[model samples]
Target chain A: MPRATSRATLFEVAAQADVSVSTVSKVLNGRAGVSDETRARIEALLQDHRYQQRSGKRQAAPLLDVLCYEVDSPFGSEVLASIEQSARLQRIGMVLSGATEQATPYAHWVDDVLRRQPVGVVLIACKLSADDRQRLRSRNIPLVMVDPAGTPAPDVPSIGSADWNGGYQATRHLIDLGHTRIGIITGPADMMASTARLSGYRAALDSAGLTGEPELVRPGRFHHADGLEQGRALLSLPDPPTAIFASSDLYALGVYEAARTLGLSIPADLSVVGYDDLSIARWAGPPLTTVHVPLVAMAEQAVHLVMRLNDEPEMAFSRIDIDTTLVVRGSTAARNISK
Target chain B: MPRATSRATLFEVAAQADVSVSTVSKVLNGRAGVSDETRARIEALLQDHRYQQRSGKRQAAPLLDVLCYEVDSPFGSEVLASIEQSARLQRIGMVLSGATEQATPYAHWVDDVLRRQPVGVVLIACKLSADDRQRLRSRNIPLVMVDPAGTPAPDVPSIGSADWNGGYQATRHLIDLGHTRIGIITGPADMMASTARLSGYRAALDSAGLTGEPELVRPGRFHHADGLEQGRALLSLPDPPTAIFASSDLYALGVYEAARTLGLSIPADLSVVGYDDLSIARWAGPPLTTVHVPLVAMAEQAVHLVMRLNDEPEMAFSRIDIDTTLVVRGSTAARNISK
Candidate 1:
């Protein structure tokens, strides 16, 4: 199963595997009839030989595969909607899969994708294992990631929002509203987007000549419970900040709950700023003031990139970051010094 | 082309169209190379002859088609996630399409579906025209609806929650809190779910020996704006109800905003009840008391029904309604007499 330096034809692979070329073709095309044991042997041979199917020779219907983390999450759903719309405009069907809790597809997902033989794969805040990547490569399937989890491979292109700028804008909005002591709810530490956002928050605080207190910063996995727990802890402090910057809209909702639990009102008692202006941001009670991540543009870019890469697989991969902006809404207000 | 009284074979249709059997086969299988005019002519002849492809003979990849009104809507997203998971577990791909504003797919949607030749089609709160329905019927494709709009055709089985029960329970909860005057935000009139809920509300009032007030019943399209506008109107009445029953979670959020604008506190000033216990329900500032529509179960049922229909197309269509339950949370409480 050692990798071959040169490409091997289907006939050659079939000969090496001691199977008919049609059997090898069936395995390559993901058609049924080949036994599991034989299919696995042929698959390994195909991978080792680095067999590449000619472009435009796909037998399956035009489909774009999407692997997303938490498909029902606000962020995932909105991005999926954008991608679905883009794919529809191009008359391509979209096949969606939910990644595991670790942000990777389940063990059988790659197998399913291979069988489906989609034109391209789009991952939204999801990751693919090296073996899975090799499998797709052997099949000549193009993949593009949206807000990839962890450090993305240099060879793989990705689309993401300007997280640092978003974090800075959210913090600056609060600071501009006369908030010197601001609490923050940061996303998971491991995610680059989260780290960048935290860094931006720190930069904003440093530029404003405000001391960054460890107690004012809380870590989270971008879950509502994280926001609620950290928000409660922050608001319960002896000298609580007048404002809080929640890095995600879901987190902001959690902060809202925390405030309500403690009998505090938004803006008046604790001005709040959130990030990722998803539709729920507008549906929030106070119509959350937050940083708007350009998810629609990012989704469109990911789809377009997939198409481009499918056509020209040799093109150099590129990373794209759409701009982010602060949306002023009813959630943020001037810090009331009287409190 | 007039409908034929008897089923016709492919060879007979090819003979009538003056085309080779292989050419007719290409058109039936949605293969390329057939001219549009010729394809149309052949399709009409096939339809006139009521040509039906063998169910198991579909050559397209195993896929299920989904047509949703708004793929990004909280309800739609949740349902889609459930279906995707179900499809994944069954080793089938789901092809998603967003329906038009009218709750019907676009003109070319049926054509695209035919080309894809999915195992079956699932409509999430979407509709199909008679012509489109006939097209799917001609191809022997199964169709199932989840929470269908309008009166579902008796022949087309649909899966939905116990809307009447849901509405009754919501209104009953408010009545149990000793609030005799309760306002309701109703969904669109054309939707059976909305009418069922509205009827349930009336029944609950009748059972509680309370007269329903026309002024208190507000119409909405299950949108945030509808809730906000209707909530404002209800609250501005000379004598406002102490409790509001928002049929949708988005509407509940809008009502929350309306209450905020009017300087009223939830539960203390006015209790609110919402339907569809989406994830946002838990994240609501004062966690919303909502009717839990079993979206996961409904989705699973829709997917399973599609599969069943595909295997046994003659199986009698059965409409299933999963149960709904009320979830008590921070949003609703006993009516306050002090106000």
Candidate 2:
């Protein structure tokens, strides 16, 4: 039997069947075109010769497709690395697509990705919009969104650190330090994490016999430069809050820069805290007191979620919120004389 | 024409051609077993009706794949993000795959990614062995490596910051400041960056009429913890070099921590310079005097190099060397007379 030719190429199959390569591809893809008689013959030959193209095993080890949307932030790269790490562990091939938040339509790109039939997708979902979410849902592709909340898609799962819990704990810690008047420098209003953290801050304030002071709560676009501006604005208030909690470590670092410019010492004149606890937080002039999100754990969870979706196609939407820790550094202190 | 009927469905095509659904699919796909007459007829119909799949536009877009083997490092994320940003500007798709340095048969993953027919691949080439490089070269995939040098596959293109220039510039800056005796903290020996930096240090010493001192140079992994150990080791020497150049910013930070522990002041008892002026360098206590490698530029170049390969597949192997600058901050100075 000529040693049962180890593997059959598409060329060999097309030549043997006296068909064009396009026809073989169509039949293999289960697209409409071949006659019933021809399909039966191809199927019979495939079964007899054990020539299974698009086998479950092949699809199981399919390529990893990645789509990265530009977020104009320093942390975007970190998130991409985390997703890439997870994709590698699954032994999947990867394709990367780049899009901007404004110029590219994510839904169209996602639809294109799905046609390639990748094993799974890791979307750096920092800025996907509502319309994009609807498109993803319509396709029902298995996806794991990092850093941003998925738009309530049935098959798409999301994994991120517990930003709300982190925010709550950070705010509660400030309150526990005897600060009645606190301020917040939030991320963009449209961001889910920003909104969630704001809610947590409100919850903590309410629990501490304090009302939500609208004056103290200001929104910034979550850039270091914005943080600096917001910091200056907060300190300039008639009765500024004793402590400030910035949503991102970079923002908090900006606040530190602002404080430096104003000669207000951290943890002494004004207490400060930050989220994401990026590497810079530890080395900031007087190490920043911030919440440490479990990035590696989040990465692992994202990969697992995507892999599981392959088996449980109808799996319920899952959200994994990894726990965060408060690293008490030199940035925050007990309010000596609070308002 | 019923408003052009919103593109023909499979059912419509089958009905129009007086064929079963499977037969129509087969004929459209040009599979064998269909008589010549049927294939020609189906082709004519498809051409007339313009029944193309939805994925046509997607296939036309540029697709770039990346495989990242390490994600734990702080700089890793930043580089990946930069690449994505650069790729996005060109309207390219990037697939990211993460793998561990310890993984064997690295080429297998590369092959899997190549099967998708990506325009080219950018490998974060850390710790890949000669054998692995050989395997990757054997695949005939258009490849560009980042951060690793001296690849066995000479034909493959690479892009990285001028680690040698960074090191030499840092050492010479210290020398120009009238510091004759200089110490060095080197990164891991096996890393290309480490080696390049070491050569640069040697060149700087030779230029300053100072022979390389083995006693003054200590090998340390490029981490803060190792930097601490190496910093302590350098300080304990009978006659420590007045100025110290640590291969990485993390290592330089470690030196700061060590100096604090030993009651030594920066640029007073000890002068320190670092490489890869990471974000934390400016925020570090008494901001570090370091060599600034244009990380974003390097990443952009890597992406451009890979993308360019798609258009010029036979382009000669290219090596892009980005410039580095000496960011003089508070970390280095003239030798202290008391010391």
Candidate 3:
């Protein structure tokens, strides 16, 4: 039986090769300035010991670290899963640095990855500051940003779904259903999706002869509880709208709950619509009418962009916009004939 | 300006060191055959090239690859997210391999991982067979099984939630409420959780002086559509049970839908209960009365177990059972007063 050999040390290799550690590293990395004989001997020894060589230098596998901040949400979980799948297919291992967007800044996460000297990084729920982005550019580290917007970092690449189009389609669907007095529930003001969805809502109303009603529009964070509260608030208004378009499925589901609590039947009392047609949408009490965003496709695109950046550092920055569709379920009807 | 140094090559170093490729490798790895004088010369040369004498050998970071086989369920995404988070915290870079349990056998996945020589592997949705387990054990590759019930290799570690206990508690709650004619909608027969939950339901009934009714039991396969069909089937029986227990929240939600379709009211005409109180449960149409499984905690535990296995291979094998809680809502009520 060939007994497993104890792992070899760098010092032993350096001493036996009659060369300095730096010379061995340069030779292993395929860097210049070493004698041909020394490089050959090092290569032979590396092969004999089964040491992995990279860039002509013998070293272990390269590291690709990831930092996900504010990852406690369901969307964060989905994005993380997709990235993991993509990373695995690429055959690159990743290290996760802890930080949530709600609790930590991007600077702290970047510092952690820098300390580890990772070959590349994927940033989720993290927005790089101009200074941080500059520093990363200086270091020549490749980066791929997911769902970030309004950043003028011309060099960095980003991947995200087309929320603007999704929102537009969702809003337009309700309009086509002959709903003039439509209500809109949006995500936070700071988020790109929220603003884009709001824009879509406005565009839909504009396309029709209807004016946007400030009273009917409410903004909240992307959460089910937020949706519930907003739903209750909207329903309490003296002249409640004929139709409501929530920015997220969770919010729409909340509206369904609110309708139930108010003793009002869906489509009979109020028409409701939602976005992000999550897994639960199809099972929502009334089977929610919502926009279906291609989550898996977005994740795959993000990973592809990140990996592409790794090979061609100078590749032109690209943006991928996946399409969304409105899945009409039982939630919407011709503006309650009774109304 | 320091122009980016072109990567160094092995030939360049060997020629400069005036040693054969084999000699250089031996000296660098610090093998016994190399003379002390030759070793010193190699060490000096490596140092000049900026390579640190790492234990007399040059080494790089190790890679940890992960393959996520598609399981064709929404819950698979959530489980995958937990595994990714855990892997990231451990500083292990993961490579995701996508395989579905329905399409590929466990042995093929094991062979692929062995060939890649990842530091370790995390298999999702792939069920291990007796032969596959033996091969994994012989290779001595650390593996962490998620949601696994049994493994042929006793030494291999596994992690999952306490589904049997959860099921028992859920059924006992319904029995305590004086529901003697309780019905159950179970997941797929092959799933360990389904079997355990069925056993729990039977135990609850037995303890409550009620015999299990085969007519009231239905196989649902854990899908909302299936649950809907099963719900309709149960209600169509000559004499339907007063209360129904769905093995999963998604299925229970489907039951709620079925009730609506049949013009029956929940907790009045038919009391409904579900498991895995997912996020949508609370805000569900009826505020589902169901069992809550701590998904985040379970995820954290699985990751912790895998990381621990990496360091202390001999750590005594133990199962971590997470407690379940019953959240009462509008779905369950006192047995019909009219009856």
Candidate 4:
């Protein structure tokens, strides 16, 4: 593997690639007129040699690159807005891009990022391939992740909310309301955050001396559709849950729709709790009782960490999980025995 | 006033400001070490002499500046996400910033823009001061607005949805459903879009030969609180209208909350129609019947127009309003006669 301390000069790289210095410069600056094959070869050679461009020569404004999995999702947008505000406060330009459906950026995204030469990159609910990581590393660009989609690489620092505690608190709130038969809609199984939340839910039930029912735990992908489908199924069971802990705010809305479709009203007929106290939580018909993820704090931490890494590249890899708190609202209520 | 055709050299600006060329260069590049007083004086001279920096000297990555009001608002985020996508497709970076509460950018936002030297600037539901406009103009940076707040400057191109037609279509939908007594919740009085929507609502009532009641008209700032406040006020009347047209989707959610608080159910007790069919509309309990604003298309147009203006700086000021359509969902129904 190429080392950061050893970097090849532009002239040396051009000589090794058997290309003119201007041709190498064109690829380096993301200018047009370079053939794709030659560009690829030069990029591979640069990576092999670990060519690091001099930062002082970059004339662009200071920028922070942000790559989000779903830029329009309620959670994604809120996180993005927070980061944009923080970046603005620090006088850093934010360059935002949406990841592809696979929770990764498009093919040419890395090329573009190399061209922009942002001070650092922040990935929200997305992952980067090893090759992409090496490319960014070769350029000496720092990267930080917020709530990474999958298992975060050991070397990359990440920021996330305390999903286990949030899940435990949400479930505990429902349990305190005399809801023994409570259902839960879980996020994607592969995500550590989702699994942690689910484990917390089970722990809460076990600690309460109640036997958790496997049938009551339904799987979902943190989508509204999943909420609607799973919610309807849960409600259709012989012994339906009196309350539900939806793992996401979006899922809670779907549950609301499900209840509405089944002629049930929130809190009165079927109580619900949600995660992520996004603005939608307040706008829900009855207002949602939810776990508030400190998105703003997390965003600030992400930006701060990325900048810190840029300044101190040798800093050890660390994970910071901000605290999560449950916000009580109108959606949750005590069980109605008569029903 | 600085003319776009006339230009001044850095040396001339420095001479006029009684400073060395390097000091003037420091201010131009937004580098530190220049005193505020001196920087101000140099900026005045640069603007006075119509100093247009040579574009070729800029080595920064291509960027499109986006200034949005209420960056986290449902409407704003969606528009931002769209523009980000379009900019990425064009290999242009998007530098996003949230405007202050006053619908104007912070004091240093313009200075930052000048330093970035973006291809162009796009303002979303935000306005620029005359001085700010002049600064951008002196730099020969093109500006475009999307659903601009207040009155759009005559010289700036803007992209907007057909608010008037949308309002007409929404009100007409309720009318066609056999509702004669209809109430309307309008957006901020100052925004041209809001006024145009109100006019369309009035035109629809007039064409239907129904007497529009002054008591039925209420005001809002396109916020959920306004929706709830105005909705409750209208619904509390001794003889309240059976149907309501909320000018924005957020207002519709507030109206939903208000109705829930008043023991009223949507479509069954009262019919509600909302504008700007954002994702929240679908997530609403009964789902919202709303006017669909072509936000993606509008965003694309904003990017395309800004880029076009950059290339053709002398293009005439123009406004494009994409068509709006009424999407009938579960929120609206025939007026209940027994209520």
Candidate 5:
């Protein structure tokens, strides 16, 4: 961190805001975590003190940090690839860290980030705890989230896709094709996206005058193995669903495996739909029909947002969600099997 | 770098070797890019000076660096995830950097690596340029290659799977299935792995007393899109091969798309074989029969080697190759059509 100018150092702002010097610095730097009220107070103090260019010791050498819940997630690779490309274009250093799934929050992850003193951080499918959130804010570091795994905190800005609508459309597509017995596979039950998607599935079923069977809905991680296991369970049920809606492309791919294991042909015997049209989706057997999540666009925009947040601390932050569309490929077909 | 012992600094070693200060540093630090004669001379000087723990500013911070040419590759994700796990266990920091193919040799990548001063670097399917090799060695950093894209330099150590044998076995399997005309998709023509696999394919045909046609081979990247295009082309030929061997699991998935587009069923119409046996491979339609590349084990071993290199500068450097096996599932079948 650079020292402030002689006219009004950060100390004065801290004194005026009745906050710690670090809090005042964070406010000055436009880092996330500070409450709007506190930020406003700090802003007023800076103006009152005739804030000048408060710069010292800061360099452009700081790395850009990326925090992901599961770096191995199917959707993670594309998003990180895009973020990395953008970082390289600007010659910014980047460090990617994943939160361990252990009971405790990332063991020493925040401390490592603090030590690196990254210019800003981008989180994907990750939610921060109160302590780490506070630490990042007080440190005056900018943070942004991409497709946050759950509902973001009150103040954390994020970029996500219209997953609920995507789910609704995918379910409705299957319904429109004369499919009443539809099974749905979702992400971890706690994830807001998963719940919203589940709700959308229910809504579609209700609108179609079909009561979705509780036995048909399976919840698991956003991974292929989970998809395969859940899909097999669904397919093995007494009254198996004719169509399956997987919450993620990876999940849907697992459904493909389940269908294959049973010697069932896609579309002919079982219609399947996936979300997050990751590049691999189009290459899946029968070219997976999926809901397209603008992965690259979201990543690019998140980087842009964090950069802006780094430069203009005074700018207000909010959530931005891109609309998702159903991409009908070769994976869906009209119901051919009798109930 | 920290200053050396009272007997002599890196400058004295450079003067004695009639080489640049960086080369002498490389020799003493046990980094690659230094010649045998020069390294021997530098070692003799250190011994003559009675080098009493001629330590420099190296610290145990011990952050591991990982570089890959294609960050979005199917195999890249699993390898990195494993590397991250190993790194966390050792309480070491890991930084992953992707070499952008847009021309400039990893624009400013070396500068960023130097700034972090990583204890060691692991390159996956990426070969450093001469300039980068020199820079890393001069900085006294250890380097290891994982599944090197091409034949690694003599001095640099590497850990890779027996791709040639894997390719040979996959071809032999197809031949055993009574398929005389087997098409093959390889990675970039320049990559050593690509050529090696292609060689193995030819060897299999020779061993079977069958003629191998160059027209049946397609050389491209280890990517799905390339697989789709090449697979489509091969299948569209007048006398399409009864079975296809794709070099990467990702490439085989693309072939699945082509098969779908051409209305051909896996194992039933056009048998397929894949390599790398990535997690997605099992979920691929028909549970792709692939050459299992021990991705996780290779990454773990690479990290272990780099750590050892970091600790013992005088330890001999050598290449290690793990065995690859054909994991048969449901993707191959006996040829039913006349050749």
Candidate 6:
């Protein structure tokens, strides 16, 4: 088995061989049907790289399940990219399904997954329903939840950041930049991450002996439009916040939309803070100073956790909370001392 | 069958009933094991909406194959979300496969897909490799290509926008904004879209009676980093362009990154335009004025086309070009007139 940190991926082998990634999977799996010439070449490359079979046993090629709530958002796409990168490194094939992507019956969906026979599954930003959990458990499919939108079931292991800390960090960053009147745009109230982040934001405010004005705290979805809607409402106040903290990068971008619409320049007029520190954060015109949750690391660890659970069911159900940090970028500024 | 533009969605039903999307799917498909009480409630809701089955004859499902270069990028994810949305409304199933996401072999992979028995296939931003095409054909799986990255195989049905027109539109927008020395960042030199877009930019430059400088035209991948690199190069020229046109939104964001790094304010110090009018383009700090390629519509039409081909293989493979429209937003402005 390859080390978890192995950077060499199966996709590289395919690119090197001038063949499809699928061809490399066949050659690695010792599956019959590939022309001997192609198989031999792939084998040689595999041996050169010391790439061993996933295990000594003749198990089917590495296939895993990746489920997402939606596929379009930057957050979803970023996490998917990280997970896919990790899976590719292990030569693991992915069978992707979206909980809301289609209305395929749970029973039928399980039947399909059983046919594919993924070694493990990763569900992102959504909770696994009880019925589906029963079916997956019955099939002995190990699963890990990442950034689950709702709470994870008691027994399931989840890998994610401390949302409370992220919120606290985002708010503190704004406070440190000298903005006492800071507003927050949070995810839906039902989401654990959202409430936790809201708590963190409150915690930060309390620590500074400042009150979090209910009027400035707007709860919204982890989406751009929600950010926009809430941002407009927040900024339209009699005395709008000098700075705002958005719970997610997508939401932060929405806030930017509102800023543009309201003719409020970022930082110079309204310093903004965002979470997720996704690529968008770094590349935004005035790079968004935000909370950096380790999305890629969380995804990689989630995949690893699933694989481990698959091999060893004796493992304890656990929750691993990755730490969040502040990445000070260009989006926030001092309140009284404007640049 | 559901009308393509209908307001009713599976999510709505799931929301109305306050059940999981899977629950709604199970109830709708008449899959074994739905409880009597829950089924009755769901059925009542279904009847209320007059939602009919996708097909009169319930022969399993309308599963179709969706292929892409990779599933992680914004562009790929956007198109996918659109397809998935449409598939959900019509109760169609989608089996997504990415060319570089895993190392599954073409022949063996086909055997797996064949087992699932998808009605048709949608290949996006990737070629229908001859071998895979042959296998899919042998299995009688109809296929449609969308925004193929490479030169599409002749005789294959394809759907895309006129990249040339998009490029022309983007450049003309900059030109009309009084940018005489407008730079452009093209996609890979070998891609059809890249060439067409380049041609369109040239056409616009010719019409404006301003010669496009080779030094100002930079070709890069449809990625943010590429945009950043090319933008820097273009801006560093002794006679830098007053405006820059990026072929894709991701690339356009890269240009935004470079502008910030160089202390240039968008639409003020430097004007930038991008193609693909993806959601990110709108939420950008200074909303990018872009040529909107109808991504969701294209994907919906592609799914429809795939189904049509599956039903009638005798139908000639066709190329459909959706018109591109220019959305005037904040990114472009009259030159040297700071806002």
Question: Residue by residue across A191-260, what tens digits does model 2's lDDT show?
Answer: 6778888998999998887997898888887677777889999998988888999988988978887886
DockQ of 4: 0.68
DockQ ranking, high to low: 4, 1, 5, 6, 3, 2
- What DockQ does each listed candidate score? 0.67, 0.18, 0.18, 0.68, 0.30, 0.20
Clashes of each: 0, 18, 93, 0, 2, 3
Give the better candidate number (3 or 4) by lDDT: 4
Which residue pairs in candidate 4 collide? none
TM-score per model for chain B alone?
0.92, 0.75, 0.73, 0.93, 0.83, 0.79
**For residues A1-339, what per-residue lDDT tens digits would candidate 3 score against the true structure?**
221123243445677788887876665443557776886676555445544322112113345666665443555655666665565565544454445435234333454454345556777645666655544443445777776633425566766677888888887888888888888888867657678889988988898879998999998876778778888888889988878898888788888887788888888788898887776778786888988878788777777776666566667776666888889999998876567
User: Clashing pairs in model 5?
Assistant: A2-A56, B2-B57
Candidate 6: residue B131 Cα off by (Å): 4.5
Error of 2 at B243 (Å): 3.6
lDDT sort, best first: 4, 1, 5, 6, 2, 3
Per-residue alpha-carbon lDDT of candidate 1 for residues B197-253, written as tens digits (9 for 90 to 100): 999999999999999999999999888899999999999999999999999998999
TM-score computed on alpha carbons, candidate 1: 0.93
Q: What is the lDDT of residue A39 in candidate 2?
A: 60
- Across A96-181, the per-residue lDDT of candidate 4 in tens digits comes to 99999878998778878888888899999999988788777767789999999877798989999999999999999988999999
The interface RMSD values of the models, given in order, are 1.9, 5.2, 6.2, 1.7, 4.3, 6.4
Spell out the clash pairs found in candidate 1: none
Give the per-residue Cα lDDT of candidate 5 at B29.
44
The ten-residue window of minimal lDDT in model 3 chain B covers B52-61
Better of 1 and 5 by DockQ: 1
